[model samples]
Target: MLNIRLASSMVSGVAGELLAAEAQTHHLRSTCSTSVSTLSSLESELESLLSKTHAIDGVTNQISSLALDTRILSLNATIEAAHAGEAGAGFAVVANAVRDLSRETAKATSTIFDHLQAVLSAVDRVQKVHEQLREQMLELDRESGVLAVRVKEQGEIVSTAVRFVDEAIDAATTPCAQAQNAPPASDTYALAPADDDYALAPADDDYGLAPVGDDYGLAPVDDDYGLAPVDEDDPYALASDEADEPPDSESMDDPYALEAV
Candidate 1:
């Protein structure tokens, strides 16, 4: 029983470790799954971001094209003003202002285009990184699934071992349990019932004679050596008597009478 108990303890210990490992593996798998989902969401959001960046880049290009068109229009107006000589003088001032405005617009558009390009480049880099992370998440999810399977298998094995150990312990202790619970066998060494006389000897007061008292054959006392007998009518026959007259003090004076009383 002791050996079986020890073995069961060891099996229970192993089972506990396996259960803990199983729980840890399950938690890790859940983490992997959540990470994978997050990565997928990030990928979709990154695509949307890239799309918006591309749209902004296209808008910047359109702005730059519009600025170029304005520059061309301003150049044409300046040429027309030059052709008009003195009439062209005030118009030339207007044409110069339009040309300067167009130049500034073009410079601003170029700056916007450079910023948009940088933004698009950043979006592309982010998309690439997101793809890599998504792949890693998928791999980790797969590995976690495998680990969960292995952990489940190990847990089952440990559980089966624990069950077997328990059964074995039960089997090992069965005889002892039965022996403890079984009625004791008729004792071969115990003395058998003796003769009727032997059994009746103790009831007959074998140790000594029966106690002697009034209930036995003892005779009642009738005399106190030489003293007079107490009268049944004596007032002081008992102190509890209601009669007030006391017995003769001379009769009580006898020591033998006092002894009898």
Candidate 2:
């Protein structure tokens, strides 16, 4: 019985019980540390994804702004075209409106394109991270790799598109100096020649106005604004007094009177 009692005391001793409890506590602490580390890593990945989403949103806003500017340019083009008239001659004369609108639109587009290029570059780098992390996720295998590849290629494509747009803006900005501010042309189609010592003679005693200058055939003009002839006593006297007067409707084409022949 004393041996049995001694054996029980040894088994239930403070040293052994305490040692076992301490080992269990250490194990729990290790497990908790691993859990904390995993959670921190997951939090970091989530933050990266959030940052990427925000970047995409910013780029989308930029694109939307560019589109709005382009729409304004389009409307301006249509409005200016409607007003250009026959005098515009060709597209060159009207090119100012087009060039101005295009330039403003190009400015907006270039800004968007530049920002987009930056975004694509950043995304490209992040895409690498997205791939490597995705591979280590311990989830789906083939789908994750394929998705990563597609995302990376899409970023590259977006970069190319942005570069193309920027180039287009630069090309459109080329200016022509002479086209915008050219002087109006000299008149080519002047009417009649000039004369000296021409006098406008008096008409009837009652009417002071006389038609004078050539055989446009005059009459005793009575009204302030000219009407036409009444019954004339003689056509010869009318012709002499008609000098300086515009040709009448009847003889307007007579080359001899105009000295054209």
Candidate 3:
């Protein structure tokens, strides 16, 4: 019984540990799932940014074209101002200022193009990195899910083992409990109901003799033998009955009784 109890305790402890492990695995799976989702979202945002960057690249090209058109218009104005001579000196000064402004605009637009290209390149690299991270996170999520399932399976196995141990403990302890609670063998037998035949039988050793006034199919007793007489038709009873017969009358008178007479 003690051994069974010890086994039960051990099984229960193992089952508890299995359950705890299952819970931890479940938590890890959840974390992995969430991380996968977050990475996926980040990848999607990166994709959106990449798309917007492409659109910005188109806009930047249009700005560069506008700067080239402005520079051309400034050059045409400067040529017209040179044709006007001294009367267009003030106009020539304004034209030179406009041409300088156009040149600066062109330089600024070129710088912006270079920076935008770098940004686009960086965005592409970032998108690729994000894709790799997303893939890794997804893989981790799947592995964690499998691990959680295995842990749960182990928990179930532990539960089954615990149940088996509990049943064994019950089986082992039941007999002892019954033995402790039940009556002793002697008392149990003594308290058993008596047979009706034995209960009705006479206490004395009357053999098969019927009472003097009774006629309940029982045989009558012989006066000398004090037992029922043997039946003539019963072959088995004749020899035993003769052997058990009382002695003759002469044998009944003792030597002491003859002396007295």
Candidate 4:
């Protein structure tokens, strides 16, 4: 019984530990879910940023097209200025300056486009990383959920085992407990007759033999067997008519007579 109780206690303790572990696993699952959600949101924001960055590529291309048109217009002005020599020297110089400005604008636009592409690439990589991280978090959450469930099952099993052990201990001890609390044989069941059920024999009535006195109704030994009465004062006196009296033949033949040696 002691061993059973110890086993029950151990099982209960294990159940409690398992319950704690289950709770922790649930908490971890929740944490993982939350992290996954955060990562998903971050990934979405990165996607949006990437989309906006790609939109900027269109604007940069428009700028580059405008710069190319400006350079072509500047070349046409320079050719017309050359056709009107000396009279359009200043216009040619201005045209050259305009072309140089357009070329510088185009270079700046290309540099901006390059930087934008790099930014987009970085954002894309970060988004992909977040996607992978989110997937991992989801997997972790699932695993934690599975762990929690198994722990709960194990805890229930342990609890059941503990209950069975407790019941076994109860079953084992019930008879002993009842015996300890039970009434004794003398109280529960009678082995001897009760006072009310039994009566003592009356002094006046003999069960089968004659009543006491008068030598229990026997004839006097002196008269019947020629023996004297026993001395009432001496407990060990032998019966005789006289100390030296010889027995008669009938007394010698009597079986009740005692002859002196």
Number of the top candidate by lDDT?
A: 4
The TM-score measured for candidate 4 stands at 0.68
Model 4: worst 10 consecutive residues (lDDT sum): 188-197
Writing each residue's lDDT as its tens digit, candidate 1 over 159-260 gives 898899888878878988999999978644343332332332234333423343323323344433322334544523323223234346665675545433
- Give lDDT for model 2: 0.51
lDDT, residue 29, model 3: 74
Compare candidates 2 and 3 on lDDT and give the better one: 3
TM per candidate = 0.68, 0.29, 0.67, 0.68
lDDT values for all models: 0.72, 0.51, 0.69, 0.78
Tens digits of per-residue lDDT for model 4, 1-261:
787888888888998999999889989988998898888788778988988999999899999999999999999999999999999999999999999999999999999999998998899789778878888898898899889889999988998888888889989999999999988663333233333234233333433344323344343344343443354344234554344455556555655556644
For model 3, residues 1-261, the per-residue Cα lDDT tens digits are: 788788779878988988888788778878878887887788788788888878887887888788778778878888888898888888878877877887887788788889889988998898888888878877887887888788788889888988998888788779989999999664322322233233333343334334433434334433445432244333223222243545344434533211111
The runs of at least 3 residues in candidate 4 whose Cα sits more than 4 Å from the true structure, single-residue gaps closed, are 174-261
Ranking by TM-score: 1, 4, 3, 2
Compose the digit string of candidate 2's lDDT tens values, residues 1-261.
355445445534533554455455555545545555665576577667657756765765676576567557656656665677654346444555555665666676667667766766776676676556545543333444455455555555555655555555445444434546677764433332323233232322222222344345354544333432221333223333334444465553433333212
